[model samples]
Target: MAAQGVFITFEGIDGSGKSTQARRLADHLRAIGRDVVLTREPGGSPGAEEIRRLVLEGDPDRWSAETEILLFTAARRDHLEKTIAPALAAGKAVICDRFADSTRLYQGITRGDLRGVVDQLHALMIGREPDLTFIIDMDPALGLARAKGRNGAEERFEDFGEALQQKMRAGFLDLAREFADRCVVVDGNRGIDAVAADVARLADGRLG
Candidate 1:
Protein backbone atom coordinates (compact mmCIF):
# COMPACT_ATOMS: atom_id res chain seq x y z
CA MET A 1 0.00 0.00 0.00
CA ALA A 2 1.10 3.56 -0.54
CA ALA A 3 2.31 5.50 2.47
CA GLN A 4 0.04 7.94 4.24
CA GLY A 5 0.00 11.31 2.51
CA VAL A 6 1.15 14.59 3.95
CA PHE A 7 -1.41 17.32 4.62
CA ILE A 8 -0.27 20.95 4.67
CA THR A 9 -2.30 24.12 5.09
CA PHE A 10 -1.56 27.82 4.81
CA GLU A 11 -3.02 30.47 7.10
CA GLY A 12 -2.63 34.21 7.47
CA ILE A 13 -4.27 37.57 7.02
CA ASP A 14 -6.19 38.10 3.77
CA GLY A 15 -3.17 39.09 1.69
CA SER A 16 -0.31 37.50 3.58
CA GLY A 17 0.58 35.65 0.35
CA LYS A 18 -0.34 32.25 1.75
CA SER A 19 -2.27 31.35 -1.40
CA THR A 20 0.66 32.08 -3.69
CA GLN A 21 3.01 30.24 -1.36
CA ALA A 22 0.70 27.26 -1.27
CA ARG A 23 0.74 27.11 -5.06
CA ARG A 24 4.50 27.50 -5.23
CA LEU A 25 5.09 24.73 -2.72
CA ALA A 26 2.68 22.45 -4.57
CA ASP A 27 4.59 23.10 -7.77
CA HIS A 28 7.87 22.43 -5.98
CA LEU A 29 6.62 19.14 -4.63
CA ARG A 30 5.28 18.01 -7.99
CA ALA A 31 8.54 18.93 -9.73
CA ILE A 32 10.32 16.56 -7.36
CA GLY A 33 7.97 13.70 -8.36
CA ARG A 34 5.70 13.99 -5.38
CA ASP A 35 2.00 13.48 -6.08
CA VAL A 36 0.23 16.66 -4.93
CA VAL A 37 -3.36 17.86 -4.63
CA LEU A 38 -3.61 21.63 -4.31
CA THR A 39 -6.90 23.05 -3.12
CA ARG A 40 -8.50 25.83 -1.10
CA GLU A 41 -10.99 26.00 1.69
CA PRO A 42 -14.64 27.12 1.45
CA GLY A 43 -14.59 26.09 -2.21
CA GLY A 44 -12.45 23.05 -2.82
CA SER A 45 -15.46 20.84 -3.59
CA PRO A 46 -18.54 21.68 -5.67
CA GLY A 47 -21.02 21.96 -2.83
CA ALA A 48 -18.59 23.98 -0.79
CA GLU A 49 -17.99 26.33 -3.70
CA GLU A 50 -21.67 27.15 -3.84
CA ILE A 51 -21.65 27.83 -0.14
CA ARG A 52 -18.60 30.00 -0.60
CA ARG A 53 -20.50 32.23 -3.00
CA LEU A 54 -23.33 32.59 -0.54
CA VAL A 55 -21.10 33.40 2.41
CA LEU A 56 -18.50 35.53 0.66
CA GLU A 57 -20.60 37.46 -1.83
CA GLY A 58 -23.63 39.70 -1.22
CA ASP A 59 -24.13 42.29 1.51
CA PRO A 60 -21.64 42.16 4.32
CA ASP A 61 -24.60 41.89 6.68
CA ARG A 62 -26.42 39.32 4.60
CA TRP A 63 -26.08 36.78 7.36
CA SER A 64 -25.54 37.18 11.05
CA ALA A 65 -22.10 36.29 12.34
CA GLU A 66 -23.39 33.08 13.88
CA THR A 67 -25.17 31.99 10.71
CA GLU A 68 -22.08 32.75 8.71
CA ILE A 69 -20.07 30.54 11.02
CA LEU A 70 -22.51 27.68 10.49
CA LEU A 71 -22.30 28.13 6.74
CA PHE A 72 -18.51 28.03 6.90
CA THR A 73 -18.52 24.88 8.99
CA ALA A 74 -20.89 23.12 6.61
CA ALA A 75 -18.79 24.13 3.66
CA ARG A 76 -15.67 22.92 5.45
CA ARG A 77 -17.27 19.58 6.14
CA ASP A 78 -18.06 19.22 2.47
CA HIS A 79 -14.53 20.16 1.47
CA LEU A 80 -13.14 17.61 3.86
CA GLU A 81 -15.39 14.79 2.71
CA LYS A 82 -15.42 15.43 -1.02
CA THR A 83 -11.93 16.75 -1.70
CA ILE A 84 -9.46 16.33 1.13
CA ALA A 85 -10.31 12.82 2.26
CA PRO A 86 -10.27 11.18 -1.16
CA ALA A 87 -6.98 12.84 -2.12
CA LEU A 88 -5.26 11.81 1.09
CA ALA A 89 -6.64 8.27 0.92
CA ALA A 90 -5.01 8.02 -2.51
CA GLY A 91 -1.66 8.89 -0.85
CA LYS A 92 -1.36 12.25 -2.58
CA ALA A 93 0.10 15.16 -0.68
CA VAL A 94 -2.45 17.94 -0.19
CA ILE A 95 -1.63 21.63 0.04
CA CYS A 96 -4.58 23.76 1.01
CA ASP A 97 -4.53 27.53 0.86
CA ARG A 98 -6.60 27.98 4.00
CA PHE A 99 -8.34 25.87 6.58
CA ALA A 100 -10.13 26.01 9.92
CA ASP A 101 -7.72 28.64 11.19
CA SER A 102 -9.40 31.19 8.97
CA THR A 103 -12.77 30.26 10.43
CA ARG A 104 -11.51 30.53 13.99
CA LEU A 105 -10.03 33.94 13.43
CA TYR A 106 -12.89 35.30 11.38
CA GLN A 107 -15.54 34.03 13.74
CA GLY A 108 -13.58 35.02 16.84
CA ILE A 109 -13.21 38.55 15.59
CA THR A 110 -16.73 38.85 14.23
CA ARG A 111 -18.75 37.17 16.95
CA GLY A 112 -16.48 38.17 19.85
CA ASP A 113 -17.49 35.29 22.16
CA LEU A 114 -17.72 32.56 19.53
CA ARG A 115 -14.27 31.08 19.85
CA GLY A 116 -15.43 28.23 22.04
CA VAL A 117 -18.32 27.53 19.71
CA VAL A 118 -15.97 27.49 16.76
CA ASP A 119 -13.76 24.92 18.46
CA GLN A 120 -16.72 22.76 19.35
CA LEU A 121 -18.15 22.81 15.85
CA HIS A 122 -14.79 22.03 14.34
CA ALA A 123 -14.21 19.07 16.63
CA LEU A 124 -17.69 17.77 16.05
CA MET A 125 -17.84 18.07 12.25
CA ILE A 126 -14.27 18.27 11.03
CA GLY A 127 -12.02 16.65 13.58
CA ARG A 128 -9.05 16.32 11.30
CA GLU A 129 -6.12 18.73 11.30
CA PRO A 130 -3.36 19.28 8.82
CA ASP A 131 0.02 17.64 9.43
CA LEU A 132 1.70 21.01 8.89
CA THR A 133 0.33 24.52 8.81
CA PHE A 134 2.27 27.57 7.73
CA ILE A 135 1.08 30.83 9.25
CA ILE A 136 2.52 33.57 7.07
CA ASP A 137 3.31 36.39 9.47
CA MET A 138 3.19 39.98 8.26
CA ASP A 139 2.08 43.46 9.23
CA PRO A 140 -1.67 44.03 8.85
CA ALA A 141 -1.14 47.33 7.07
CA LEU A 142 1.00 45.70 4.44
CA GLY A 143 -1.36 42.81 4.07
CA LEU A 144 -4.40 45.05 3.82
CA ALA A 145 -2.71 47.15 1.18
CA ARG A 146 -1.93 44.03 -0.78
CA ALA A 147 -5.53 42.86 -0.43
CA LYS A 148 -6.89 46.20 -1.59
CA GLY A 149 -4.70 46.09 -4.65
CA ARG A 150 -6.46 42.93 -5.73
CA ASN A 151 -10.05 43.74 -4.87
CA GLY A 152 -12.39 41.00 -6.05
CA ALA A 153 -15.95 39.82 -5.46
CA GLU A 154 -14.90 38.46 -2.11
CA GLU A 155 -14.46 41.84 -0.52
CA ARG A 156 -16.94 40.88 2.19
CA PHE A 157 -14.22 39.93 4.67
CA GLU A 158 -11.71 42.52 3.53
CA ASP A 159 -14.25 45.20 4.32
CA PHE A 160 -13.25 44.82 7.95
CA GLY A 161 -10.25 47.01 7.12
CA GLU A 162 -6.88 47.39 8.86
CA ALA A 163 -8.10 47.24 12.44
CA LEU A 164 -9.75 43.88 11.98
CA GLN A 165 -6.85 42.66 9.91
CA GLN A 166 -4.57 43.39 12.86
CA LYS A 167 -6.82 41.36 15.12
CA MET A 168 -6.89 38.47 12.65
CA ARG A 169 -3.11 38.47 12.39
CA ALA A 170 -2.84 38.24 16.15
CA GLY A 171 -5.30 35.36 16.15
CA PHE A 172 -3.28 33.40 13.59
CA LEU A 173 -0.05 33.99 15.53
CA ASP A 174 -1.74 32.84 18.70
CA LEU A 175 -2.93 29.67 16.95
CA ALA A 176 0.61 29.01 15.76
CA ARG A 177 1.78 29.15 19.36
CA GLU A 178 -1.08 27.04 20.67
CA PHE A 179 -0.54 24.39 18.00
CA ALA A 180 3.20 24.59 17.75
CA ASP A 181 3.51 20.88 17.08
CA ARG A 182 2.15 21.24 13.55
CA CYS A 183 2.28 24.97 12.89
CA VAL A 184 5.20 26.95 11.45
CA VAL A 185 5.49 30.70 11.35
CA VAL A 186 7.05 31.99 8.15
CA ASP A 187 7.94 35.67 7.86
CA GLY A 188 5.90 37.05 4.97
CA ASN A 189 6.65 40.77 4.94
CA ARG A 190 9.16 40.38 2.14
CA GLY A 191 8.72 40.07 -1.62
CA ILE A 192 6.62 37.26 -3.13
CA ASP A 193 9.49 35.14 -4.41
CA ALA A 194 11.35 35.42 -1.10
CA VAL A 195 8.29 34.41 0.92
CA ALA A 196 7.43 31.60 -1.48
CA ALA A 197 11.01 30.32 -1.33
CA ASP A 198 10.96 30.34 2.46
CA VAL A 199 7.65 28.50 2.57
CA ALA A 200 8.89 25.95 0.04
CA ARG A 201 12.03 25.36 2.07
CA LEU A 202 10.08 24.83 5.26
CA ALA A 203 7.57 22.54 3.52
CA ASP A 204 10.42 20.53 1.96
CA GLY A 205 11.82 19.97 5.41
CA ARG A 206 8.48 18.59 6.53
CA LEU A 207 8.27 16.32 3.48
CA GLY A 208 11.69 14.83 4.24
Candidate 2:
Protein backbone atom coordinates (compact mmCIF):
# COMPACT_ATOMS: atom_id res chain seq x y z
CA MET A 1 0.00 0.00 0.00
CA ALA A 2 1.13 3.55 -0.60
CA ALA A 3 2.22 5.43 2.53
CA GLN A 4 -0.38 7.79 3.92
CA GLY A 5 2.36 10.37 4.35
CA VAL A 6 6.11 10.49 4.81
CA PHE A 7 7.43 11.04 8.33
CA ILE A 8 10.98 12.28 8.68
CA THR A 9 12.80 12.95 11.96
CA PHE A 10 15.98 14.92 12.58
CA GLU A 11 18.25 14.16 15.55
CA GLY A 12 21.61 15.13 16.95
CA ILE A 13 23.49 16.45 19.95
CA ASP A 14 23.04 20.11 20.93
CA GLY A 15 24.35 22.59 18.31
CA SER A 16 24.23 19.99 15.53
CA GLY A 17 21.60 22.15 13.78
CA LYS A 18 18.93 19.45 13.48
CA SER A 19 16.21 22.03 14.08
CA THR A 20 17.58 24.37 11.43
CA GLN A 21 17.90 21.63 8.85
CA ALA A 22 14.50 20.21 9.66
CA ARG A 23 12.93 23.61 8.96
CA ARG A 24 14.91 23.91 5.74
CA LEU A 25 13.69 20.54 4.57
CA ALA A 26 10.10 21.51 5.32
CA ASP A 27 10.47 24.71 3.31
CA HIS A 28 12.00 22.81 0.42
CA LEU A 29 9.10 20.36 0.38
CA ARG A 30 6.54 23.16 0.45
CA ALA A 31 8.32 24.86 -2.41
CA ILE A 32 7.84 21.70 -4.45
CA GLY A 33 4.08 21.74 -3.81
CA ARG A 34 3.93 19.15 -1.05
CA ASP A 35 1.75 19.46 2.01
CA VAL A 36 3.98 19.47 5.08
CA VAL A 37 3.83 19.94 8.82
CA LEU A 38 6.94 21.01 10.68
CA THR A 39 7.05 20.16 14.36
CA ARG A 40 9.19 18.89 17.23
CA GLU A 41 9.22 16.32 19.95
CA PRO A 42 8.10 16.86 23.56
CA GLY A 43 6.11 19.92 22.52
CA GLY A 44 4.12 19.53 19.31
CA SER A 45 0.70 19.36 20.99
CA PRO A 46 -0.72 21.48 23.80
CA GLY A 47 -0.56 18.76 26.43
CA ALA A 48 2.85 17.74 25.21
CA GLU A 49 4.09 21.31 25.40
CA GLU A 50 3.28 21.44 29.10
CA ILE A 51 5.14 18.23 29.63
CA ARG A 52 8.03 19.58 27.64
CA ARG A 53 8.48 22.59 29.90
CA LEU A 54 8.36 20.40 32.96
CA VAL A 55 10.87 17.97 31.57
CA LEU A 56 13.28 20.54 30.21
CA GLU A 57 13.11 23.13 32.96
CA GLY A 58 12.38 21.11 36.06
CA ASP A 59 15.10 20.47 38.61
CA PRO A 60 17.54 17.97 37.19
CA ASP A 61 18.75 16.86 40.62
CA ARG A 62 15.24 15.74 41.49
CA TRP A 63 14.67 13.75 38.32
CA SER A 64 15.36 10.04 38.26
CA ALA A 65 16.16 8.15 35.11
CA GLU A 66 12.92 6.19 35.31
CA THR A 67 10.88 9.33 35.84
CA GLU A 68 12.60 11.04 32.96
CA ILE A 69 11.86 8.17 30.62
CA LEU A 70 8.20 8.06 31.60
CA LEU A 71 7.81 11.83 31.18
CA PHE A 72 9.31 11.63 27.71
CA THR A 73 6.92 8.82 26.81
CA ALA A 74 3.98 10.80 28.09
CA ALA A 75 4.87 13.77 25.92
CA ARG A 76 5.46 11.53 22.94
CA ARG A 77 2.09 9.84 23.34
CA ASP A 78 0.34 13.18 23.22
CA HIS A 79 2.46 14.37 20.30
CA LEU A 80 1.59 11.29 18.32
CA GLU A 81 -2.13 11.47 18.97
CA LYS A 82 -2.53 15.22 18.53
CA THR A 83 0.02 16.09 15.86
CA ILE A 84 1.78 13.30 14.00
CA ALA A 85 -1.00 10.77 13.40
CA PRO A 86 -3.43 13.38 12.13
CA ALA A 87 -0.96 14.89 9.67
CA LEU A 88 -0.07 11.50 8.24
CA ALA A 89 -3.72 10.51 8.02
CA ALA A 90 -4.30 13.64 5.95
CA GLY A 91 -1.38 12.90 3.63
CA LYS A 92 0.82 15.80 4.79
CA ALA A 93 4.52 15.11 5.10
CA VAL A 94 5.65 15.59 8.72
CA ILE A 95 9.15 16.80 9.41
CA CYS A 96 10.05 16.70 13.07
CA ASP A 97 13.02 18.37 14.70
CA ARG A 98 13.44 15.59 17.22
CA PHE A 99 11.45 12.54 18.19
CA ALA A 100 11.79 9.04 19.64
CA ASP A 101 15.49 8.94 18.91
CA SER A 102 16.09 11.88 21.23
CA THR A 103 14.52 9.89 23.99
CA ARG A 104 16.73 6.93 23.16
CA LEU A 105 19.89 9.00 23.21
CA TYR A 106 19.18 11.21 26.22
CA GLN A 107 17.50 8.57 28.33
CA GLY A 108 19.93 5.87 27.31
CA ILE A 109 22.88 7.96 28.38
CA THR A 110 21.23 8.79 31.67
CA ARG A 111 20.13 5.18 32.28
CA GLY A 112 23.25 3.42 30.97
CA ASP A 113 21.56 0.86 28.73
CA LEU A 114 20.84 1.84 25.13
CA ARG A 115 19.09 -1.39 24.12
CA GLY A 116 16.78 -1.41 27.12
CA VAL A 117 15.69 2.19 26.61
CA VAL A 118 15.13 1.66 22.89
CA ASP A 119 13.04 -1.40 23.61
CA GLN A 120 10.90 0.43 26.14
CA LEU A 121 10.30 3.39 23.80
CA HIS A 122 9.59 1.06 20.88
CA ALA A 123 7.01 -0.77 22.91
CA LEU A 124 5.47 2.47 24.04
CA MET A 125 5.28 3.73 20.47
CA ILE A 126 3.32 0.69 19.23
CA GLY A 127 5.04 0.60 15.83
CA ARG A 128 4.86 4.26 14.84
CA GLU A 129 8.27 4.71 13.24
CA PRO A 130 9.65 7.46 11.08
CA ASP A 131 10.12 6.67 7.37
CA LEU A 132 13.56 8.26 7.65
CA THR A 133 15.75 9.75 10.41
CA PHE A 134 18.68 12.06 9.81
CA ILE A 135 21.24 12.11 12.58
CA ILE A 136 23.23 15.34 12.22
CA ASP A 137 26.41 13.96 13.68
CA MET A 138 28.77 16.46 15.32
CA ASP A 139 31.82 16.36 17.56
CA PRO A 140 30.80 16.59 21.20
CA ALA A 141 33.32 19.27 22.12
CA LEU A 142 32.52 21.37 19.11
CA GLY A 143 28.80 20.89 19.53
CA LEU A 144 28.91 21.91 23.17
CA ALA A 145 30.98 24.93 22.29
CA ARG A 146 28.49 25.94 19.69
CA ALA A 147 25.60 25.39 22.06
CA LYS A 148 27.29 27.59 24.64
CA GLY A 149 27.91 30.25 22.03
CA ARG A 150 24.19 30.41 21.31
CA ASN A 151 23.83 32.25 24.67
CA GLY A 152 20.42 31.02 25.67
CA ALA A 153 19.01 30.16 29.04
CA GLU A 154 20.39 26.78 30.01
CA GLU A 155 17.91 23.94 30.25
CA ARG A 156 18.47 21.23 32.84
CA PHE A 157 20.11 18.97 30.31
CA GLU A 158 22.27 21.76 28.98
CA ASP A 159 23.82 22.10 32.41
CA PHE A 160 25.18 18.58 32.22
CA GLY A 161 28.95 18.23 32.36
CA GLU A 162 31.19 17.47 29.43
CA ALA A 163 31.32 13.80 30.31
CA LEU A 164 27.56 13.52 30.17
CA GLN A 165 27.43 15.28 26.81
CA GLN A 166 30.01 12.88 25.44
CA LYS A 167 27.96 9.95 26.67
CA MET A 168 24.89 11.36 24.97
CA ARG A 169 26.84 11.67 21.73
CA ALA A 170 27.86 8.04 21.98
CA GLY A 171 24.30 7.06 22.71
CA PHE A 172 23.13 8.75 19.49
CA LEU A 173 25.74 6.89 17.44
CA ASP A 174 24.73 3.61 19.03
CA LEU A 175 21.12 4.28 18.19
CA ALA A 176 22.00 5.04 14.56
CA ARG A 177 23.78 1.71 14.37
CA GLU A 178 20.89 -0.22 15.84
CA PHE A 179 18.48 1.42 13.42
CA ALA A 180 20.87 1.57 10.50
CA ASP A 181 18.26 0.98 7.82
CA ARG A 182 16.15 3.98 8.83
CA CYS A 183 18.94 6.32 9.92
CA VAL A 184 21.24 8.54 7.87
CA VAL A 185 24.10 10.01 9.88
CA VAL A 186 24.96 13.32 8.27
CA ASP A 187 28.15 15.13 9.19
CA GLY A 188 27.18 18.49 10.69
CA ASN A 189 30.45 20.36 10.57
CA ARG A 190 29.65 22.17 7.37
CA GLY A 191 28.03 25.55 6.75
CA ILE A 192 24.26 25.87 7.18
CA ASP A 193 23.46 26.06 3.47
CA ALA A 194 25.57 23.01 2.72
CA VAL A 195 23.92 21.03 5.50
CA ALA A 196 20.50 22.21 4.43
CA ALA A 197 21.21 21.08 0.87
CA ASP A 198 21.98 17.58 2.08
CA VAL A 199 18.76 17.42 4.10
CA ALA A 200 16.81 18.84 1.17
CA ARG A 201 18.16 16.14 -1.12
CA LEU A 202 17.19 13.45 1.35
CA ALA A 203 13.67 14.77 1.74
CA ASP A 204 13.27 15.26 -1.99
CA GLY A 205 14.29 11.67 -2.62
CA ARG A 206 11.68 10.37 -0.21
CA LEU A 207 8.91 12.73 -1.35
CA GLY A 208 9.60 12.08 -5.02
Q: What pairs collide in candidate 2?
A: none
lDDT of each: 0.88, 0.81
Cα RMSD (Å) per model?
A: 1.5, 1.9
For each candidate, give its TM-score against the true structure.
Answer: 0.96, 0.92
Runs of candidate 2 with Cα error greater than 4 angstroms are 1-3, 114-118
Task: Report clashes for each candidate as comma-separated counts.
Answer: 0, 0
Please give the lDDT score for candidate 1: 0.88
lDDT of 1 by residue, 81-129 (tens): 9989999998999899899888888885544778888889999999999
Q: Which ten residues in a row have the lowest lDDT in candidate 2?
A: 108-117
Give the lDDT of residue 112 in candidate 1.
76
